[model samples]
Target: MQFLFADCVLDEERRELTRASQAVSVGPQVFDLLLYLVQNRDRVVSKDHMIESVWGGRIVSESTLTSHINAVRKAIGDSGEEQLLVRTVPRKGFRFVADVSEAQNPERLSTDASILSLEATKPSIAVLPFQNLSGDPDQAYFADGVVEEIITALSRVRWLFVIARNSSFTYRDRDVDLKQVGRELGVGYVLEGSLRKVGDLVRITGQLIDASTGTHLWAERFEGQLENIFALQDEISASVVGAIAPQVELAEIERAKRNPTRCATAYDCYLRGLAQMHRGDEEAIGEAITFFKRTIEIDVESASAHAMAAWCYFWRKVNGWSTDLDKDESEGLRMAQRAVELGRDDAVALTRGGHALAHFTRDLDTGIALLDRAIFLNPNLASAWFLGGFLRTWHGECESAIEHFERAMRLSPVDPELYRMQGGIAMAHLFAGRIEEASVWAERSYRNLPSFLMVVALLASTRALSGRQEDARRAIEDVQRLNPSLRVSNIADWLPISRPEHIAVFADGLRKAGLAE
Candidate 1:
């Protein structure tokens, strides 16, 4: 059925809307709300009725409903003030006030609504309830909460379609075929996991599968002490989403790669860059930067791409791979500033751009503030927490820095950058005068990545402070091997240590460890 009103046609068959012969981009929820309003044009549908029909009776905030309503009006070229079509009936609900005529058949091709309704051609997934292996009713409740949190986090990814918890939970405790679940849920992928509790520790295992093919895409296990149940749940949610997001994107990228004739879009270029960046090698990072640059050229307002390009430069500087430090730093700073300017509310942009700005400009406060805003926007973003921890460590917030690092580590336990977070913890411990703990973490970080200059330096300092002369000497040798130019006198120039006391302590340790003054 097609509804025509005020130069706009809403095609129910295609799940599309066109205004003045031009396609109007509308979100699924917004489109559903508009259709519901038009179908009940003769009556003022109450909020309860709208929620039941449009949102499947899920609990929605007033702001969310209002925003969808506003989007519906904007799509139809109407407004709250004018109320030319959709009108708010005060305490009642909404009514489509315009004349609507329906047509049984249209000339346009009738595409499958299954593909069209799934985020307008994007891939969609449903996260099934994790089985409670402990057989305890309380554990089952906890598992449900974990799934709910995972769904909430996945919803933040703009490119993916997430089935609502209510819909996904309908398969709870039911043994169903993966392909059947896919067809029933109208999704391409499904995530199922199991939760088990042992003593004061909880273990959660999750696996992502291609529902249509019954092929496993990714799987991982997370275990942590239940010191604080709520915090643990948050951590598991972050880790699950963080791991799953990249796997899903990589799967999509591979799918796109398989289609040799498909033209590359800005998003395709961005995804390719993301895959390269995750490789974390000098040459791969350089290639990632090129891909991101191509993305920017294709879409000039690609804030995340710009931020990633700047971050690649920062990565080069950190690893001493910059052939021309001055040129790279300037270019990186420009992109970082541009990213923050264009992406005030974008969490990824703010996190990467803020960290790059902090590194290139040495403006620790601004960088910390921007990262804090990113955390506020997306608390599950592990990079924001860990990177913010770095700035906080330099800013002399020792305890707070440690908490951030721990939280980040928990959020992505298997993250390739785990070494970085380990090094951050060592730095924080060293600053707090915990030599033994610092040495332990520094050694762990050095074992993970021996070439990491900061870890080597921290190891030398902590070993020297702990009165281990021979071990400190070996670490000092490794540090000089990594960066021969680094000296006790130039500690401040090497790192952004803003606190005089922290600087004094770090330099004193390096001096005792045999670095030249």
Candidate 2:
């Protein structure tokens, strides 16, 4: 018998596997494993069944079995990350997820792999129901509610594909292997946790795992009073989603980078762009723009890509790295507008594009409206919250701006852009006439990113306003080095302070700190 699939031919009588007419040097066990998977392509082959059939019921260590599976995949140009052909079924078994046909001279007919491919080949996750460890049956509902809320929260992430609760709950109370769950549910990551209730206090523990690799990427514990069960549910859900999103994003970026460039997809290019964007340096931002441009070329309607590309220009402008200011502004606004037009429901696109509009067009009202809509779409999105806070600060909504910044910090406490959030809080304080608070936050932000122009300016302004002459002078020196062209006279052009009084506050500090008018 002979089977042909994905340019590889498996011959049973001669016991040979050939690719592009060249024979593959597979070991006996690997050959048998491949043959068994191909023969059972109509269904998943359980690990036990595979061991019994291939290893003759002998005891085989997990590492040995994994090695054999890897060998088979390598022989056929498949990888664990890609899972293009051989797929792992979490808590289930393995399946050959490829099309196969019998050779003309074959004695047996070929069965097509029954499992269909994922509709969207993006990063996907499944959230299982949290176990109730409280020793009370009534606590199950609360645990279930937390899982449902997490699923709902994760669904709001436009870039993530989350499994529905109905499908995920099917494995309730099942002691399933994480890798098996990944294969069965066809997800890259899995979130599992437990909840415990004691008197008026509740404790929840959660862990995020790379299902394919069975690697625990993140784990944390949350404790809160259960005075209001629903409120506690909301808090835990937000915290879990906020912590897991960044980890999953980082894992996806690394996976995309691992794939060969020759086979890079639009999603892969976008992920690479995001990776570069997080570096937040001049050269890295330029490379990020290039990757985003490539993504746009491949997928012109990619709203998030357009928004990110626009924001790259905004970053360059704010950091004083743009070599062509007019070109950057024009191109940035064009992309930002297009992103808003295309992605009315995408929070990330709306957040980045709206900030660009606020910075480049000075349409603060329109920008704030877009950001508010984004928050409505995904309330847990930290970027939307922080960027909205920034616009509010420029628009003289000092108290409201501080609230938004605080909310963003709560959402993503260890965010990569923590310094930006800190800077926003400082600016709000400076505008609200809280010099001591502004100085503390600005100094903390400066320590994280010394070259951040706004933070440096804030430090100088707050120090000068608080009568710290020498410290203010040092901050002014750092500011001058970061942006040599900046002066007190042209502060309005640099920052769009809507109120004349707010501009006066910023300028007075700079003037006091020896910035020439």
Candidate 3:
């Protein structure tokens, strides 16, 4: 008989256990203990019964039995804390509480909804159940939790559409075809992973695949101590998202950090604010400002809070959402300076605060230096590269600007701000006098973010410079539609340009496209 629960299968006839199609290794005593439990899952098995049946009636000490049981738990991915499959009935014997499916034949089976085929508009992904390789069947809970956390993290990204857990879990019972899963789930990508727990350590393996062509995009393995399992989960989730995004890399900056104040609620509030900040909209920025301020009220020494709040103000300035430029910029500069001072060693805090400083003060040299330090601190930070690239373009380093923008794009191709990266590329081309290429790239950027005034302006300028008069005129209409008060005379103030020639080149397009002088 073959018994299956979660992603693990135990074959009694073969005296074997496999997870995710991989053979698991367990000691003979632990194997017998697990098998006896599954075979008699309907009833509890006492210590005396286990000793007699599995140990050939040999004399077994309480410590010996406890050690073997613990081994069984370790081998299956279960712990004393999380007893999902194995349950201790007070002073009585142990019982298997999980719902078990038994099959006489060895063939795999799946009852969960199988994917047929559907068209997905944006980058869509499904995180299937991770196979538990802890020879012990109880480890299913650990594997399941890991998948859930990954799904949650990915779903937080506004752009990528994530398949619901129920839909993705349908394939948990059996092997699946990538193409069918893609079609049935209406997704472009599938993320498959496995978990293995051995002694004090655990190893996780994840692979991202293009469902349509069965092409393997990326695969990674992570190993860490069980004590830091939560931290390891964050690392894996961030890495998995980074891989799928094609260089859209971000470090697991949170790293299971509990608030120094020992307040979970306060920490949660801070995190909620971070989610809103990443949305990058005027309304969302305002929402984040409120959240971050509350976090400061709860914990006075929150460097991250100060940094993010500083960024909210800077973003407002760049987008022309600020009502009072003087007051906002002053406060923004102070918050940004505080974040930088406090987060001397924190890459996330430094990156955010440094970007805000660069924009608020227009100090290109200082901004670029701080961002460079941020990258040195955490090489996977894509935001730093993208921000620095834009700064470089304004500083008249077009080649370097193009390189940085491309680097950011490669890291996070499916990033929600993908249009911004494309727009930066257009700006670089515009500065370098590659008018036709600039026009093409700008048009693509505008399509992705039609309401973005910067992109609209870019398209207009590039088109006019490239002799695409009609296209340029349409771009002007779009930009003016968003902000009719914008005029060529003041357009230079909106652009973060330092070099006179670069500003002139950009303004020429807007002027030619019929903006008011």
- Please name the candidate that would achieve the greatest lDDT relative to the true structure: 2
Tens digit of per-residue lDDT, candidate 1, span 1-517: 9999999999988787889997765656778889999999999999999999987787766876887798888889999999999999999888999999999855644223463345234578999999999867788988999999999998876567899999999999999887788877878789999999999989999999987678999899999888898889888898899787766766766765665633255666777787777766678889989998987765555678889999999988776678898999999999999789657777889999999999899999999999999888778777899999999999999999999999888766777678989999999999998889998999898888787788888988888888998989998898887777788988887778999999998888888999988
The superposed Cα distance between candidate 2 and the true structure at residue 334, in angstroms, equals 0.3
Q: Distance (Å) between predicted and true CA of 453, model 2?
A: 1.0
Sorted on lDDT, highest at the top, how do the candidates line up? 2, 1, 3
lDDT for each candidate structure:
0.85, 0.87, 0.75
Q: Against the hidden true structure, what lDDT does model 3 obtain? A: 0.75
lDDT (Cα, tens digit) per residue for candidate 3, span 99-132: 8899896453231222211121125688899988
**Model 1 Cα shift for residue 264 (angstroms):** 2.7
Write down the worst ten-residue block by lDDT for model 1.
Answer: 108-117
How displaced is residue 388 in candidate 1, in Å? 1.0
What overall lDDT, based on C-alpha atoms, would model 1 receive against the true structure?
A: 0.85
